[model samples]
Target: MAENEPWQDPRLPEDARLTSLEKRLKQAQLEDAARSGRNDKASHKGRSQGMRILSDLVGIPFGSALIGWLIDGWLGTRPWVMLALLFLGFGIAVRNVLWIARQRPE
Candidate 1:
C-alpha cells in the first residue's frame, strides 16, 4: 500500500473491529471518571444510606423533645416536668430504632 493511504489490517473481522472500538471507548470513559474521584452508583448508595440514618436519629430525638417541651410549657410546669418528658421521649426513640432494625432485611 502507499505510505499516505490509510492502513486496513485484514486479520480483524468487521464485527470484531466495532466491538473492540466500543470496549475501548467505555474503558477510556471509566478511567477518566476514576481519575477525577467521581462517586459512582455504589458510593452514592452508601452516602445516601448514611445520611438517612443520621437524619432518622436526629429527627426522632428533636421531634419528640420539641413536642414534650411544648406540652410541659403549656401545662405551666417548670424544668423538672420537661426533663421527665424528655427522658420518656428518648425511651420511645430507642424503641422505634429497635423496631426499625428488626424490620430491615439481612
Candidate 2:
C-alpha cells in the first residue's frame, strides 16, 4: 500500500501527503482493532461457555446429593435415597457433558 501511494505524486503538496499518510495510519490501526476485537469476542464467548458447562457439571450432582441426603434423613430411610440420587445426579452430569461436547462448533 505504501509503495502504491498517491502521496508520492509530484503535484501533491507536502501537507497533502502528510494528511494522506496520517489517514492511512489511522485506517491501519482501525483494521488492526477490528481484527483483534473479533478474536477477543470469540475467545471470551468460548471461555464463558466452558465456565457455564463446568458449573453445571459440578453443581447439579452436588445439589442432587444434598437434597437426597436431606430427604433420607427426614424419612428415616438412611442410605437408600442418598445412594440412588447420587447415581442419578452423576448420570445427569455425564449426559450434560456429552450433550455439550456433541453440540460444540467444528
Off by over 4 Å in 1: 1-39, 88-106
RMSD of each: 10.6, 10.3
lDDT of 1: 0.68
| Top-lDDT structure, candidate number | 2
lDDT of 1 by residue, 1-106 (tens): 5322347666645666668889999999999988986647656665665566566677766776787778778888766666776777677766766665554231
Off by over 4 Å in 2: 1-38
Per-residue lDDT of candidate 2, residues 3-64 (tens digit): 33766777645576668999999999889979866545667667777886898788988998
**Cα shift from native, residue 9, model 1 (Å):** 36
Which window of 10 residues has the lowest lDDT sum in candidate 2? 3-12
What is the TM-score of candidate 2?
Answer: 0.59
Worst 10 residues of 1 by lDDT: 97-106
